[model samples]
Every structure is written in structure tokens, then in C-alpha cells.
Target: MTGSGHRALGLAAAALTVTGAVLVGTGVLPPATPPAPPQAVEASHPSRGRTPETGSRSAAPVLPRSEPRRLDVPRIGVHVPLSRLGLNADGTVQVPPVDRPEQAGWYARGYTPGERGAAVILGHVDGDGRRGVFHDLGRLRRGDTVSVTRADGSVATFVVQSVEQVPKSRFPSQRVYGPLDHAGLRLVTCGGGFDRQTGHYRDNVIVYARLA
Candidate 1:
């Protein structure tokens, strides 16, 4: 996707609607009052031409374009098939259906997983009185792994580099969807407190990872 496309998609995805209800298995509700999003800024560490998660100086290898079939986050027990998402009539990005909280959606207009650009995946935090596919997204730490199984029968493994929770008003559009030097992946979901007035979460949780 182009820079403009990235910005648009990021902003649209950031505005996801999340219902603040009891979490499945946890039996806990989100805070009524929204908490301030994290203010930490990520510093880039350049090592030759390699991706941030790797030590090699050589350019990272990229795969040919292929649709992603599934996503796996072993640490959080997330294993779900991916659905193709496109822009809506209003030009906003489409999201996974709230009724199916266990499914994830991939930005079909952007780079596919394993391609030399950021491939974005969006899931709900919670919905339909149950925890969503990415409900535990905030618990992921640096060095965690996320893998995408592609249509070509190859899996693209990515190593988590950073995670951020930012208000939808200040979503990092450029950083999350901008062109990259190597293959990258971004997992996004709603977080922060539930807003009864708006029926949406106040913040978004984004995970940045690079091909490994």
C-alpha cells in the first residue's frame, strides 16, 4: 500500500468498535473509565540493512505475493483462519464481523504476509459476550513469535519487536503501515477502557513484528 493508503487504513482500523463486556474464561469487565494510552516512543536501531529483529547485515529474504490462510500466536493460544478485508463504501477499512470474535481479518489491499512490506491483521478485543481472538494481545512481550500460513503452503514467521497501546485519536498511521525495508507484520486490536457512551474502546493495541 502507498503511504496515503497506509495512513487511511491505520486510522480506520484504529477506530474499531469494541464492546466492553465480561471476558470469556476470565469473567472480568474492562474499566469503565478509560485509561491514558501508553506514551512510550520506539527508537529505531539500525544494524546494516537487516530488519530490526535480526542481527544479519544482509537484506531480508521476501516471499512472493500470496494470500494468508491462517494466523497463530502460540503464547496466547490464538489460532484462527484469516478473512480478506477491503475498503468500505466510505473508504474506511473493513473489519472482522463482531459476531465472529474468533476470526481475524487481513488487509487485502496491502502487502501479504512474507512480502517486503507491512502486512496488517485486525481482530476484536472482545465481542458477542466472549473474548475475541486477540483478547490477550496486550500480554505479548518482545521476542514472542507470530506466524502466518500463506496460500502457497509456506509459513512466514515473525519475531515481535514492540507493542504499543495508543488512543485511536493518535493512531500511528505512518509507522504501522508505511513502506518497510523488510517483510513486516502488524497485529491490531482494541484495548483500554470501554466507553459506554460510544460503545467503543478508547485505545488500540498494536504489535510490530518483523520476518524471522
Candidate 2:
């Protein structure tokens, strides 16, 4: 897609996914100097596609306010602790440390998981020449489960409804981040192909899930 077409969605998704850092930062491990492989890209791209229809009944009941502490995706073999992330000085969502690519982060400014709005989580695909958290995110399928442990020692489970890949230029911000009538989850990662010149990905992979 042309840069012009991606500008708006790019900015919106960037505001929430920290895509600018992926485009410019070197994917090197902290306290080390070795240059990371070119393919070690962050999982972030501006993207949006059709929103999945919400079912009347959810498998899990929505809980009250609680911060997420851990995330587990059995299908992807992901079991990682989560850090709370806020916005940067530039007003974009703050991302997990690049050196600690194995970790994932939750957007603290938005609704907590199991609430009535869409909860967002982000992770890197690869860095420091190794697989990063969410590297297998694209492998998740409908009906797969994502479990998030909250601060209250409660586990809120979400079932995948759909997975989509859309170009950054066509990112559907409203569909992705807009208010939801039910508790929802969105997992975002960089996909498609890497753009060597821009040091970014051409598309984003989003996994939509509802409380179950």
C-alpha cells in the first residue's frame, strides 16, 4: 500500500502499538552490543479488518476492575508475565522493553481484561535474532483460548473469534479500539512481510477474542 493510504491508520495504530520504534530502533539485547538480525522485527503494523459478531453468551463471566498479571496461550506455548504500559512522551502507547522481547505488555489506559470494553495486549515477534513473545500469535485459530490472570487472583478466559491480517494503510481503528458492548480482547503483532527500507512490517495480525 502507498504511504499516503497508511498515514492515518498508521498514526492511530502507532499511537497504540509503538510502531515508530520498530521502524527505527535496533533490535539489540540490552547491555550487549551485537547487532540483531534484520528479520528480528517487532510485532506491530497498522491494521484493521472486519469486526467479528459478538455472540449472546460468553463462556466466561466478566469480572470487575483488575489489572492483568499474566497471560497464557496454550496453543502457542506462551506463558509470560505481563507488565503495565502507558503512553510515551509522544502520546503513543509505551511498549515493552525491546531487550526483554519474551515479555508482553497490557495497555493500562484502556479497560482491564474482563471488563466491558476491549482490552489490548501487545508483544514483539522477534528481537536479538530470537523468537519474541507472540511469535506464534498468528498460529492461533478460532476457539483457541487465551487466559489472563488478574491481580485479584482471578483468571479471565477469552475465546478466539477471528484472526485477521490487514495492511497498515487500511487499519480499522474504530473496529479494533472502539467501545464494545461486551468484554473483549485484541492481540496485535507484526506480520505479512518486513520492509527493509522502512524497517517495519507491511501488515498487522490481530486476534479477536471475547470473554469465555
Candidate 3:
């Protein structure tokens, strides 16, 4: 979907549940305060965004034995605790308390970083003038390093491969939030541009990375 279309879809979804502090509004008002999420659900990685298999099957990502607890981005100088949340009925993830509007905590109860599948983390770009944790996420590029401090006190590195700003309308199901050949990381933020009437950012920025 086009960038503008994402705002429409996201706002439409937000409108339904009357989302709490995390209103998912335009850049004008203060960003909504995200809510707490449920525990993590353990599952294997799915091959939704992989190259089509010819006659042979492909291998999947091997998750680390230890789970991740903190995330660090040296390029951006970010060292923050991880938090998680489940998606609302509209498919948008519930927000978490981090710092700025663009930043959010991971749904900790769910998938851990370096797990067999994708570890999803989301934040807002700017809400009502407040900047969230992932506000600068759009700046990430392939090869950029994302380090995670695991619950076991071990650090794992990931290499970024893609940074896409997709419209909320055509959510990148397989592309943005899909599983990896091994443990991976998914970073989400609301960006592109802002709309006054719709009360939502123009596009959704997603950062994809694989364990290093």
C-alpha cells in the first residue's frame, strides 16, 4: 500500500477500539500512552517472506538457547530495556511505556530476542509532540548492527538487511513481521509524514535484521 494509505488504515483501526493513551493519532496531538501486553507465545518461524521453494526445502533460523532482555543500537546509541505487547483487533500492536512516543517496550511475555522466530518491537515516531523510542528507526540500513543483551547476560548482534516504510493499509505481513531463517529482530515505527484530519502518521517504518 502507498504511504498515505497506511495512516488511513491505522487510524481506522484505532478508531474502532477507541484505543487508550496510544490513540495512534496524527502528528498534532500528544501521542497516546500505550497499554501493557500479554505474555509471549512460543512458535516456530513461518516462511511467509522467503524465496519460493523449487523442489527442495529450505532450512529455518536457529534460535539461541538464552532469551534477550535488552536492545542496543550502537549507530544510534540506544540502550533500552525490552517490552512487548499483543496486537489489537485491528492488527496494530498495543503500545508500551518506554520513553518518547516513538519508542515502545517489547511484549516481553512473548518471543524473546534471538529466539527461533522474529522478535517484534514497535514504537511511535511522534505523538502530540512526544518522540517515541523508535523515532529514528527509519535511519537504519542493511549491515547496521543491532545488539541485544540477553536474559542470560550474553550479547548477540544482528545485521540489518532492509528498512521499509510501508503503508498501514497493505501491512507487510511476510516482509516486516515474518519469521527468519534464524532468530531475527523486527523494529516498527510510525513515520513517512503526518496528516491533520486523519490523526496518523503517513507511513509505517519497519527494520528487519538477522542474528549476527
Candidate 4:
């Protein structure tokens, strides 16, 4: 999907949901506070500007787009099947069920794995007081590899370009979800310090990767 279209679709809801979860996890908010409605979490962070993907390093040529079936990040010991996620009635991106926090999900409406754009994979940091699939996502570093297996039996490999933790309020939406020249990957989860009063993590950890 075009960057603008993605923004219009469910980006707002996705951002909100991510931020809300982080806040709730840190206990920054009341435990009684209900999770954002199904349509409440896509793209809670708005990106008004765009950043060009630039670097001396170049990723492999783009591969055909395909539905991702599984993900493997050896460094973090993650090997989980992927579920398709679409937008909710309110236009927020769909999220993996909280009850199955160990699973990861892909934004099916957006770029597919190996396509010429940024493919987003989201997972919870924690749920039910246990670690979620992406609990260690922040520990990844540049040069780490993330592999995604597609239904076609092809594996797309991505090399981590950068890993950053930024305040949810200052999330770099354009940079993270914006269109890219190559097949890019974005792994996201909550990070930073937990706010005792609010019950939310103050920051988000994003891992930027490109096809390899």
C-alpha cells in the first residue's frame, strides 16, 4: 500500500493500541482501564514527514510479494507462526489476540514480506504477566538477521539496520512505516522504563531491517 493510504487506513489505531498497551503494562494507568476497543490501536502515532531510506549498504533485489507464514529471529530465540492482520471496523489495524500473546502478526493490508516496501510485524511485549513473543525484541542489534518464511516456501532474509527506543509520544511514524525503495522489515514492541503511576512503558523499541 502507498504510504499515504497506509496512514489513512489503520495507522492511527495501530499507534494508539501500541501506546496504550505499553502504558497499561507499566502500570501508569489504572488496571481497570479497559484496553482500546478493537479499532483503537492501529497507527496511534501520526507521521507528518517522510525520511528517505539512505545508506551505503544495499539490500538484495526485491522478491515477489507473498503472505508470510512464519518468522525466525535466532538471536532472540523467536520462531513463531504469523497470522494475517487487517483493519478493524474503526480502521485500526488488527492485532493478535491478547490471549495468544506468544504469537506474532503481520499487517496483511500493507506490504507483504519480500515486497518493495516496509513490511510491519507486531507482537506484544507481555500479556497475562508473562513474556510475549517480542519481549526481547529490543535486544536485537544492527547486523542481526530476521528470517520470514512465506507460504511459497521461500525464506526472505532481512538484516537489521538499526534498533531504537523512542518515546511513544515521539514515535517516528514516517520513518518506520513510510515507503522504502527496497523490501524492508520493521519489528516493533514496547520498551523504555515502566511508569509506576501510569502503568505504561514510556517508549517503543523498533528494529529496522532490509532484505538480504
TM-score per candidate, in order?
Answer: 0.78, 0.78, 0.67, 0.78
Clashing pairs in 2: 6-169, 43-190, 44-190, 46-168, 48-172, 59-212, 60-212
lDDT against the true structure, per candidate, is 0.71, 0.69, 0.56, 0.70
Assess the local accuracy of residue 162 in candidate 4 as a C-alpha lDDT between 0 and 100.
Answer: 71
Model 2 over residues 69-113: C-alpha lDDT tens digits?
A: 999999889999999877667766677776777889887777788
Output the lDDT of residue 205, model 4. Answer: 68
Comparing 1 and 3 by TM-score, which wins?
1
Off by over 4 Å in 3: 1-61, 87-92, 97-103
For model 3, the run of ten residues with the poorest summed lDDT: 35-44
lDDT of 3 at 183: 70
Assess candidate 3 and give its TM-score to the true structure. 0.67
Q: How do the residues 111-207 of candidate 1 rate in per-residue lDDT, one tens digit apiece?
A: 8999988888988776676778888887777889999999999999998987777666656666666678789898987777676666666677778
| Per-residue lDDT over 82-125 for candidate 4, one digit per residue giving the tens place of the 0 to 100 score | 99876667566566776666888897877888888788898877
Count backbone overlaps in model 3: 33
- Error in Å for residue 57 of model 4: 7.3
